[model samples]
Target chain A: MSNVIEVKNLTKSYKEIKALNDLSFEVTEGEILGLLGPNGSGKSTTINCILSLLKYDEGSITVFGKDMKPDSYDIKAKLGVVFQDVAVFDELTVYENIDYFCGLYIKDKATRKKYVEEAIDLVSLSEFKKFYPKKLSGGLLRRLNIACGIAHKPKLIFLDEPTVAVDPQSRNSILEGIMKLRDMGATIVYTTHYMEEVEMICDRVIIIDKGHVLASGTTDELKRLAKIDEKIIVEANSFDSKYIEEIKSFKAVHSADYKERVLTVSYKEGADNLVKIIEYLKKNHIKYSRVYSERPTLNDVFLELTGKELRD
Target chain B: MFVHNFKYSLKALFRNKTLIFWTLMFPIILGTFFKMAFSNVTSSEAFKAINFAVVEDDNFKNDEVFVTVIKELSDEDGDNRIFDTTYVENEDEAKELLVDGKIDGYLVMPDKKDDTPGVTFINNGINQTIIKNVVEEIALNEKIGNEIGETIVKDEMAKGNFNIDIDGIYEKVMEKMSDETNLLDKSANKLDYSMIEFYTLIAMTCIYGGMLSIASINNSLANISQKGKRVSVAPTRKLVTVLSSLLASYVIQLVGLALLFVYTIFALNIDYGDNIAKVILLGAVGSLAGLAMGLFVGTVFKAGENAKTGILIAITMFFCNFAGMFGITMKYITDTKMPWLTKINPVGLITDGLYALYYYNTTDRFSADIINLIILTLVLTAVSFFSIRRRRYDSI
Candidate 1:
């Protein structure tokens, strides 16, 4: 697929501090590219620079093979951006807000109306169409914000932390809607600190830290970058400290940690690691309430790369 | 795009309760209060004829011109009477009237031919001032009349016409002095001191249009509001958006001004003079200046909306006070003492324009005020445009 956006050697600074340091990335057409990073790690800055909403200190950005500029009306007409902050007008109703923003790009009344209604339906905000922003709940307001941003139905959409501070149901709905947008032949650039969200909807992921791109790949490929293949957790009321040392002695066990009545062991390369731990627990007469094993997650990859959790 | 933005901008500005209160309700309420405060002041404080006694001594009786002037001024049946003169037989009786407070002052004839007439009063006041002014004017006119009579007699003798008519020369001198010394020219428009308050109120109302423009402009600048950020990202040109929003604000401001005019003219029965069209024109230009001020405050300052609003209020009230909204005396003081302040102030310009329209026979002053207001509006708009046209910012 051709690239919808390209940024080479991108750099941005806030006085003495750099916000984006040699940040480089490409968003392929018709795919969801996740920009995963902690707070203040240049995720929003990168998106702003790409959309020409900000002036970077160095490097260049191009959208649809043309240089992005503040007056690039043609490129801007075909692009949609949902900023991290809710940007809908409080004085307008949900429907009016959507219609107003959509009218910015779509001049036809009939088409704008149809698109506004479709957007409301996509974000499940049809029931609250007549409600003002001040009357809507936080999650519903977020949905309205999304609907307003995407009502124009642009070929490329930028969703910057669209699901921040939302309930599970709203987050799920937002993720599903983004997936639908990707399925409808639009290139999507999604930014969030939620690793699970990146894992769920992102076709390709780029992990960023302190304004640097640490790693980039599919979810599974990124996960492989972790030092461990499998992780096991055992919950018990009582556990001897010696068992952690014993677990670490296992050939496949990369490390073991025990705290707060739970013992976790990570395997470097192993199958049936949970079974092995369960058999060992039984032979040692150690009573465990539950034992489980799972594949390494993107958080593990981030921790391996930056020595910190993705949320930190 | 302009229409779309304009339509929504109107809706947004109209729905803003804060903007509505400051731009419409606040000025109207303040005007109502001003009306109530100044309703009866003009009538109660109007000028009344002063009372005084004149001693009919030998010198007073011998001066026919002075006696005739006093009789004409003290004629109760005359329309131009300025004094309630009480004739006394001697100086003792006039002094008794002055001491008893029955008269503001008494006019005493000179005992010697070379001495001037004198006035006596128990207290200094408007009535005493009027009496003193009248006595001094009569003395000066007598001196001028004597001088003219001598000049005419000498000129006639030089022409060899020795039968000089002294009475005719005195009559001509009196006529000429009367014609030349009439300094007060009553205008066709009545002197309404209360109208100054109303004019300043109108000026206040016009400058209050700044609030509406500030709110509208705030919604158009990317660094000021979230909605502005959304607008900045749109494909439409920034000029169209800014101009359309300002036009909507201007229309609303004009409507508010029109309502004020209707209220003050019809309901309160206040007369805004005969030049209603010029008054409206001044209000329109003044409102434009107000909008320009708002645009300047909104874009030039990096402060928040509330801070900018505080600054606008400070500016509007400052100009209004200087324009005599608080009191007519302030307007006079500013106009006489600090005319440059009034020249630069939008509210002062509007108030002075309205004052000129109501009080003057010509439109020269009013036209100059209008021109100054338009120039001020253009300058503010140019500066604000320069500030607002910047598409990129160092920070949001």
Candidate 2:
């Protein structure tokens, strides 16, 4: 297997907090992997471990089939990172800044120049080439940051919350740019709280909670694993508890509840499930004002697995 | 690694205009201040004139030649005068002048008592300075005349004709006197090598250069050192990043010093003499020492920017200022009364060496200074290497 990054039983802790507990994962060549986790669920910690930025209590990590040390320049040269916080030189103009960081990996002046221009074009920062970070707006700065990071054209890229706090337009542009990078053969390790972003871009997703991997698979596959398949809510002026018992008799009806003048029904999928619920409600003469249904989402899965209490 | 690190570092440093201002232009501004202070005329107008009261007998006061010299000596000029000279009618008048605070001195040319001449100077809580000095010097001149007369007479008697060799005896006496003095005087004017004073100044340059190095390195480390931790996941090594930052700092120091030297040498009319090349070379070494110091601080301090900037500044100031190495070896040049500090300051060593070359052209003070500077650079370099290598980006 051509693995760009690999981790085996990696455990990392800070003080008393076990940030990563026996975490093991790997990224295959040219695959964009989404690392999904709630805050303090050790998403960043795992990335740090994979990058060898943090020393784990157990397990080992290898990048490009070599033992990584702090001074692993060869590995570092092929790696590009855009941190959650914008990291770009404020003093340098956009072009100069890109050239400077790009020059580190590519020695040839002509090649460096070409890569820099390409990066500028990629991020659509050509017009702001001469502007410093201060001169650019928040969105422009974020784009410039991406350009600086990817201009070096590292084989592997780690983007942590790249779209956080950006305007929707810039965020959309950034996401497109990231997809283009993946299309161009750059493997990406992305982390974010936004589920749609993962679903939209990630080839596969890894869901971690409390320093351990809760689930990992394609988004659809992960959704299939969730016990809570669907939810149904009926708002009404009045309802009887006896109707819940009758609704439970229907096929595939796992549970039914009638409380606070409204009857709520949740169940696994089955043929004619909605039709049976309506017939039961009608026979019982429960006047419903509103009704709604939703399939299992990543947010539901996260809320169920990690609990809704704030981590920090 | 070299160019990459240098480029990034340069980019980073230019972001801080405050640091650049203090490190680069401040010194030249200070030098300009000194230039203005030393070059402009120091008006004696600030000081009160010394009052002179001469109790001369009528014999000398009536003499035209003596009166002319007196007038020439105690003269007043445009808005400023050396002394307020008063002619007293008698000793009582002179005493009254002294009592009234009207005069600083009194000179009484008494009647000739000894075979020579006598000049009695009196003062009531006042000094008889100028006139007393003149009278005594006149007496000494007479004594010199007597000696020269005796010599001439003795030589004429010995020789059939009056011809004597002055050069031979004068040369011997001058040589003997020179030998008795300290060696500091040996190359006072010769630029054969760097002088001790020059070495002290070069050391001072290192001290000031260290300011930017420390500031930039610490600022980068504290703010984004963690960024390295994040970057470590890539194909890049932390050391390369560090080296690039250091290289950038070195370039900054070079630029700052070059600007200063250019302005000082060309614009401000500072003379580096034939030692221009030597100054540049020594300056490069000084820049290295400064960068080494910066790297050391950056690596050693893992806390926030406040702590880093504070500690770096403290270290730079302590080492540079304490050694009298930064500017003219302050103690050695101005003879500032800082005994212990000037002795051990390492920055002093580099600056003193360069200063000697640039100014006095004496090399005696240079060897020790160069040795000291080399040792300091090595020590700082070692510190930078060890600290940066061992320090983790997240370690506080």
The DockQ leader among the candidates is 1
Worst 10 residues of 2 chain A by lDDT: A47-56
What's the DockQ for every one of the candidates? 0.55, 0.27
What's the DockQ of model 2?
0.27
Model 2 residue runs over 4 Å out of place are A71-74, A232-291, B11-16, B33-205, B214-245, B262-285, B305-307, B316-362, B391-396
| Number of the top TM-score candidate | 1
C-alpha RMSD for every candidate:
8.8, 11.6
Per-residue CA lDDT of model 2 for B314-360, tens digit only, reads 76556555444343334333223553454345565455555555533
The positional error of residue A170 in candidate 2, measured at the CA in angstroms, is 1.7
How much lDDT does each candidate structure score?
Answer: 0.84, 0.66
Residues B322-383, candidate 1, lDDT per residue (tens digit)? 88777666775676569899889999999889977765535667899999999999999999
